[model samples]
Target: MKMKKKNKGGLLFLMSVVLGGFLGGFVGMFKAGAESNGIILDVKILIPWISAICLLIGFISILLTFNFLKKSRKFHSLYQEEMDDDLNEIYYVQMYRNLEFGTIAFNITTVAILLALFISVSEVVILNRSNLTLSLSFLGLVLIFNVQKYFYKTIAIVRQFDLAFFSTPKDVLEYINSYDEGERQANLEQSFRILFQLNQYVLPVLYIFLFIISFLTGEIQLLAFLLVGAIHIYINVMQLPMVKRYFK
Candidate 1:
């Protein structure tokens, strides 16, 4: 068992290294292409295709997200209806799992929407000044409302779990005792830790890519990337004091 675990860990590390190298090479190739050929695409044609793809995917994600929210509500209702200890325990577990899955699904969909928004705005900027119009960017703006609606629905569904959502310190303590105790809370914290670690590792590469692309294109609007990258770094730095305090 120990050998198998070690082998699995090593395999994962190897795969990550290979994937990172491939991505780095791809970025380098793009940079080379840009430098040599002054790489440019016809945004008049490209923007429409990208906008269509984004809208189609965003619509599908929104539909699936609402479906997940409906399932969560169903699970919450079933959990409330159960009476026997064993049966209620089953329902409780199902409900908890549903909430966890729904939260992850919601986040994934939100990221897709945000990416669509980013690409839409980026493409708008890429368009020639004389040819620019909101008609090309309408889908992205539509997705902003979708994101807002999804955010509200996600919060509403989570709050349907009566034991969760707290308005006061006492309520928070009660919530911790009732819903977030033991392994569940630990898992939630561990997920955030993993995300933070991932951001730390990936953000530098992302910043470098942004710089490379901007240098190749001479587009100052890529300053957006710098602003976002700085905010990410600041957030990470802000968390360090708490991390030190925790260890101390």
Candidate 2:
């Protein structure tokens, strides 16, 4: 227990330091960018704005990471508890960790994209005053579609896990200690209903839309799309028990 306490203290310290650095860099980046650009760096004033935007993104990244880390630590603690014969607690605990991991990935990606967008915007604004000439007619569209495909898949996994964990009563959600059978049945029913809806319609629809958008935008987006797919697959695999139980 002492060791565990020390570990959490270390993690919190790290989170604080990281958050402070990100926030500092964030403000400094924009201040420098804006000062460097003066007033009208371009007709759109894109030069200064992009850096500021990235700064804002970095700020968001810090927040999400902080939240993710905190939540994961909590889950880790829960994981130490003894399990019942049903072993449902483990499933919920695992689900929470997986969700936290997914959130971490998403935040990391956001940070990357935030940087990329700033860099790309800067290039477009200053070094090269040029129109984006990449044709969206063929492969570009394909790449975009693929990215969308994976994005939807990722969303589906996250949603499925969320609903399953929240709705399933047997193992992870065993806390609905209703003395009355009617109340317990209602709780289970509500959970099942929620999962059923999310697993069937919400996830599929989201995937279709994501895939379609990528298709329309072009193949340039494929790499981004694949990352989304990878994360989705990860969460799906990670939330194995809850997903399967509700799904079946």
Candidate 3:
């Protein structure tokens, strides 16, 4: 009886699953928000709260998932396998290099946007620069780029791992956490199933809210924004499977 080793497959599977669904669901939420539900508050505090809540949840979910994976079959092997430390480090570093770059870029851009937005909100800026459209567009770009970056990285991780597997079966048993190609595909199918179910429920309700809010507020511009946001969400959701399968 032998213990399994930590395979890159399981890590890749989970990353694809959670991140795929997370991205879809998050976009769905934005779509829902864009539908004019007539949500109103102190702009000063409201904007900050919106930003804070998302950033908090992103960090928290990552942390919680890290702990859960540590307990699940997804964890690295109890018995370590021998490897060159430098090689191991290099492998991980190369895989994660873009992820690091993306994060830093996202942070710098977001901070700049926020500062510009904050300045625009005050009388100090007479340029009328901040608007609903600009804010939403930036958010939309962030969502697209963030998801794109992760999927690109995920594919690279999978390919590199597959190549590594050509050398040894250690990755087959312990590295992948199981000896089933079915498991890899299962991760993807499960994520889409959840996403489709979620979108089916979310989109209609979001639209209804939009219709009602525009009527109540007498702001037809809100309707335009809602339409744009919902379209973006739909495009992302509908095309995501194709994008996911491209790596195959």
Query: Which is the leading candidate under lDDT?
Result: 1
Q: What are the clashing pairs of model 1? A: none
lDDT score for candidate 3 against the true structure: 0.48
Clashes of each: 0, 12, 3
| TM-score of every candidate | 0.59, 0.28, 0.36
Across 1-248, the per-residue lDDT of candidate 3 in tens digits comes to: 12233456567678867875776676566556756575542235444445444444444433343333233211122112327676555544443443334434445444544543453344224543344534543454455454434433443343333324133655534534432486557656876886775566556546555654454444554755677577658856778777889966
Q: Write the number of the candidate with greater lDDT, choosing between 2 and 3.
A: 2
How would you encode candidate 1's per-residue C-alpha lDDT over 1-248 as one tens digit per residue?
Answer: 99999999899889978986887788778777866896663335566566557556656766666676666667677777877888878766776666556566556655665655666666657654222223433554575466446544554555532433224767645544555456457877996887676676666556766765565455754666967677777877878987999999
User: How well is each residue in 113-160 modelled by candidate 2, as lDDT tens digits?
Assistant: 456455555556666754232121222234333433443344344333
Ranked by TM-score, the better of candidates 1 and 3 is: 1
Better of 1 and 2 by TM-score: 1
Q: Candidate 1: what lDDT?
A: 0.63
As a TM-score, model 2 comes out at 0.28
Candidate 1 Cα misplacement greater than 4 A, ranges: 1-48, 84-86, 114-178, 211-225, 240-248
Whole-model lDDT values for every prediction: 0.63, 0.51, 0.48
* Leading candidate by TM-score: 1
Q: Which residue runs of candidate 3 sit more than 4 Å off their true CA positions?
A: 1-45, 65-74, 79-179, 221-248
Name the regions of candidate 2 deviating beyond 4 angstroms: 1-43, 84-248
Sort the candidates on lDDT, descending order. 1, 2, 3
